[model samples]
Target: MVSHERENHFVISTRSYQADVCGKHLITHKPAIHECYGKGCDRMFPTISGMFIHLESGTCPSKITLKDVNAVVAMYTHHNSIIHSDYNKSLAAMLNREDPPDGFPFHCPGFTPGSLCGKRFELFSGLLQHCESRACNHTFGQDDGGLLSFLHKVLYSESALFKLGRLKANVYSRIELVFPEVLRDGEQEHLEALLILLQMLFRKLLDIIENVQSRLKAAISKHINYQILGLSLGHPSNLDAITGRRGDLSALAGEYASITGNEGRIAGPERMNTSEVFVWNIDTGECQLLHLFLEETTAVFEILSLETQPQ
Candidate 1:
């Protein structure tokens, strides 16, 4: 084969010469059908995946990058299986480096029946062994460099950190998260108990909030008019001291508005410089406290109730 290649042939058919060049044929034996829509790159390929390889290999005259292709692909929800976003920046940086770090993230993004998918490995080689042994079915490495192209783009652009493409996950996948081993030696055991207790507290807080919301909802349904009987002489001068102390109060006010036929929505929250949001205000000395009550549906004197009872 070397001697045959030593002498150049003058073949009449350009196609035959290329076919028998006995060299690397980047193009497949399949028919040319996948036409690239890239600028100045109207060349066709046997398959769409081949065209992607061409684009990502940085050989196309169009100069369209892998990140460019990935960004566009992510906009299409149906193609999510072939794309990823909000990826692990640390892993991407390691992959883009010439001499990669010793450790892998060691997470398998798979969950097949009885498979060692979604399992974390203690060592980089352990991860390789897991994939090689068909645990998670070689989930990370089986994409024909389709997955590596994602990280390789980091060499050219920083946006590569959050976006990856040509990787597969289960059709019904959870929100992709990078649950790293953020603790050092001995930290896990010490912190895990406190973390568990914190989680329980969070559950209790959630339950209390749920109960509060339920009671508020029930109160609104009862159609009872609420009246502030009167204020003590020593009552805090401003509503900020008592009424608006809680962060949820504004949201509660919005709920009140929504139930009382007020359709206004708050905008320009970014402009707020103060802690309290006052719907209406006057000179500091002229302020007064009022109460809210349901207008009786049957009463003729549904006179807007603005009873300011100050003691």
Candidate 2:
């Protein structure tokens, strides 16, 4: 069960034994010393408030800024909503249609009740050509709908320092399973530290997604002509009905095919099976392991720098 406390801005999930604060989760039952749920900074705090303050202070080696945490919280709030889930399901259903049109299915906010420019297509490639030839300003926006919208907002917003943090989190989460094991005691400690950092960043990204959703919902309710509202309101097929534009997934599939020279196969957003994608690629796995080691080293340097600084 989920219990929300508006006064303290907390959400408690009994099944998960987790308490959500500002979009991030903390394991409860021990108030005096709180351990950060962030991947790398599992450090204990004297109090719950102290842990929150530490996260906000950006003192953690992961370099997770206050803005980063806030963005994550916003993202988490919207993504967990029932509306977003329903929208995704509807879009997926449309894509699975047996007899799709000739040009790509596109959603055009510019198309109101009567507009000649709002035309549908079956193939996304055709839609792209048409948009370019006609100088139309249409863009793709429905890979993960709400999540993508949140990312766009974060990208264009003023808080630019942690712009790549979310992307990094995505990459790490996907590639983490293939991480190499270490035999030496020193190497094992380093590996553990690196994994923790990755986890911390991943959690922060989730929170940001939630926070963005909440903001988007509020904005949609208040403003009639918000650009995001158009994107948010229209289902995937709505664009196809008005304008022949392809969703982000189809476009990505096409791009992947072109790059990989794979015929008739498209890459979906689903997580790749580790055995199929990485187990045989020893070199690639090693590279990821090395990358994590480098990150750990950088974090150590930052911590040392902070320690030696004159107060």
Candidate 3:
């Protein structure tokens, strides 16, 4: 005896069912019946009496109520706040201490296992000073070790999230191929929401890649500029000695040129080939022929020291 409005809320309504009231419309000689109103409970029966019997039997699936969703969100929010606050307090306490004594090596707080450069500082102040460099754009407590640990605990370690990450690439590809077929007869609103979510995920991934690429490009450019500047100031007398070792230098320079698409050549006093090398002595304000062989892939520099020990 339920009205059409009540029936609409309890069961999925269609255009054919609009003309009929009490949700007892006949479909192919069998009476079309209402489904259970509970979330995820889709059992149907030809008669209201039969539907009621099933509800009373307590075999229906457990409904996910709004209260349950709210409780989980609140619990996670509170936990995140507590952990973030404690980490911030500890960082502030560590930064307040006086600098370590001279000659004592102090490990830089920003240097984590994941950092590209594993550089240490001679003093606490030096470590703090190194943090100012853009190349080492890392924070002490917030980013050094805390962010990854927190993400591992909350996301990576979670079974569902880990599986989602692993399968996301394949899922996206499959969805691209099958989405139109699967959603052809589906609700327009649901399809639109799914599309929007997919677009957002793709855009976020693109943004992360773009950011990393830009930082890498800048670092490479800076390193090359420094190398070129050092070569420009080398003594002319050492040019012959450097030219003799051109094969080693050319190999290193060719690799750099290939990666950056920039000509790696010396343009000082006279243009030198890739095989020529240059060395600058900071202490004596002089440039000598070191004939250094640089391995581009590993970035290891082999220097042939020309200093003669007092006999």
Candidate 4:
């Protein structure tokens, strides 16, 4: 799945159609063209247009020094892989919470014998026995063990492959390890460009998370109202884990409780019927709509900024 190509310094991954250039798979987010070409181009070009044409056409300005395209390819591929691992981990976390597994294996076959071996074996045998007794129904459950196994593999497999030394050396070797010589030629600018891009990416991620949190909060509020029969029943609670850690929603919830008092309670709990279920469904739909909107927006911004370094 992971391969090195002589034509391009990048370690190509042909594992799947969905396999990402670095680690990310979204077709809309191919590696930034500028970042890719700039890697081997001169530091100073009067205009981006000049830079673009020179790189696109494989032409070089007489005054500007250019490294081999192999170096550029290496940097692009290496950085992409690092970013992919990070974003993929985050995505996995979100998906796992929304769709938890139905069952888990007691013993992890992938775990090697070592300090945790005894514990692992016990746990493993327990799950296996449990599975056999249940006719392997656990395997078919939503919480199947396969997901856990895969997670383990991705998190630990090939620990040496992604190391800084390996990635950096491989990337540098694209031009016969000329990165050091480039450094002597003023690598500071290149380093700065990389930092700017990474900073921009970090900020964008924060925006995405904040947007999701805000929408999630609203959804929670609506759910509470539908379940309790009215938002008038209680002040908004900062039930959000992020808000709670900062003491943000707690005081507000208290204030709301005081204002609403007993008036917020549904007049008849026993009288509530299946008709209210329809209302809950509607609220759920609205909540999901908000989340979807935020997600799309985040993806769009990320894609747009792919090639632009932070200003």
Candidate 5:
């Protein structure tokens, strides 16, 4: 078999076989081996990228969403060059935005009903079908600069900030695992002040929260007419027990509500995940829990600096 084989021939092994005719081969590799810990998928990979790519491709039984992949990629501080930095911000915006519009709003450019490839279509899909028909030598697939490729580019650039604008962002890491560094008792003295600072910050935040909570509690008790005061599962994601409906805060919107013609860009409670805790604002009386954690600050204008922008 070796004697009859092509010079660079190498057999790629997996649970399923790939024909040499198509490019299913894993190109990036390393000397170290790693295993896919996904359920029933113990397939070994030559590099971490290979494992993530396999899982993200939906080939593994344990399916990982592309968004989850992007989230992890954004975590690596060194990967600011290739990957999207504001992944969270963009996703929050997209999720808040209405789903993609349906049907063609405008006519197909550079084509008409009288041309050799002239079948006018009002329905958006009818035009896609025409493109895929290849009568006009335009295809929806991997054809050079076609509809699919162009949309992929748009999603790449707009939806996320991949500098190259290529889809399927994977993270390459130098360290396999992290363990805390050990320090002797004498050496730990230098870190005591930092630990004390964290404790002070937590205590300060607690005091502010308690004061605000007391005010809100008193108001809720005084205003018995408004129903959302003590609703369980008040979050928009889960159904409320008494109401048997997703708790929509927007129900409170009234004639005084500020109208901005631009919609979908404004974040809502619906964007909050099950794992996050929402913080209320005492001044605005509105919940803007868009960030993972609430940051309450008392910085004066005189103290303003680049580092104090979060305030």
Candidate 6:
């Protein structure tokens, strides 16, 4: 039998079959949310078994055995239901058009599942959850190389942090492909800042991967238990090389490679077939006027260019 009096943490009280002594504040099946539903009112309740009672019975006893309680805690924390919930809510809001366009992505455009804006929110939610778990919020928006710097370093190490980099690239490519047009000055700047932070995080992950890979090489050569080491020595470079050969693969390394500039020339040169032409005749007769207009325009442009040519 195990019991805790801490208000912040849950306690499990055990009684064999049905024998127990009562203590003050030690209420059984206390008629609160958990009493009524076997779930905590606050949302910090952890454990599948703890929740299992909530699922099976309308109410769970307040006092649970220490063994059952620990089992619940291990499963719940390992599964990370709380963090998943937070991330899901963020993504759902973006996907469902519930979030107002605020600092970044200034344009909602509409709810397209495969759109850049949607993808950004999705990846952002994931990254945000990871940051929260690591308690990385304190450094956000701080000047003099604080949180922002930390995030930047994390993003830039993408080559090493295989998973983070892969996820970021996926999101980045989706954005670049969908929103390949000029953005407002403010929006553009905001996107740049966001990319910087993402890049920093990615870079850190890469460094970790590099270290892991070095260890992996040594482990394999020396017949070490790589699995026991629990390191993330990654094959990101090899993976990248292989994936790069695929026809569907795009150059996702470049930031905003598809974000348009002032002149509106596409950021990446897209090969287009120009061999096909369509001609229409207004009166089923030779329409020489349109051709003449084109010729005159071309000649005038040429004359202007030649006269204004420098040296």
Deviation of model 4 at 11, angstroms = 48
| Candidate 2 segments whose C-alpha is farther than 4 A from its true place | 1-90, 93-176, 180-189, 201-213, 221-311
- Find the number of clashing residue pairs for candidate 3: 1
lDDT (C-alpha) at residue 291 in model 1: 16
Q: Which ten residues in a row have the lowest lDDT in candidate 6?
A: 272-281
Return the top candidate by lDDT: 2
Model 2 CA lDDT for position 61:
53
In model 3, residue pairs whose N, Cα or C atoms come closer than 3 Å (at least 3 residues apart or on different chains), thus clashing, are: 246-275
Candidate 5 runs further than 4 Å off: 1-32, 37-39, 76-81, 84-311
Cα error, residue 121 of model 2, in Å, equals: 7.0
What lDDT, from 0 to 1, does candidate 2 have?
A: 0.36
- Which 10 successive residues of model 2 have the least lDDT summed? 272-281
Model 1 lDDT per residue over 12-120, tens place: 3323333213322322345888576443456887655566567655465544444444443332223234322223343333332213223433455555567635655
Worst 10 residues of 3 by lDDT: 300-309
Clash number for candidate 2:
39
lDDT of 5 by residue, 5-86 (tens): 2344664444433322222232231344666634335688764445555655545543332343443323323323322333
- For each candidate, the alpha-carbon lDDT, in order, equals 0.33, 0.36, 0.30, 0.27, 0.30, 0.28
Candidate 6: which stretches are off by over 4 Å?
1-184, 209-311
For 1-311, candidate 4 gives per-residue lDDT tens digits of 24334234565645544222432222223333322122223345432223433533434321111222212211221223212232333333322223211232123222222332211222222433333232222331223233323222221111111121121221112111112232323334433343333223333233333343343335333212212111112212422322222222234333323432333221222332212111111212222232232222233333223212243
Error of 1 at 234 (Å): 53
Candidate 2 TM-score over all chains jointly: 0.22
The TM-score that candidate 3 achieves is 0.15
- Regions more than 4 Å wrong, model 1: 1-28, 78-80, 83-311
Q: Estimate each model's TM-score.
A: 0.22, 0.22, 0.15, 0.19, 0.22, 0.19
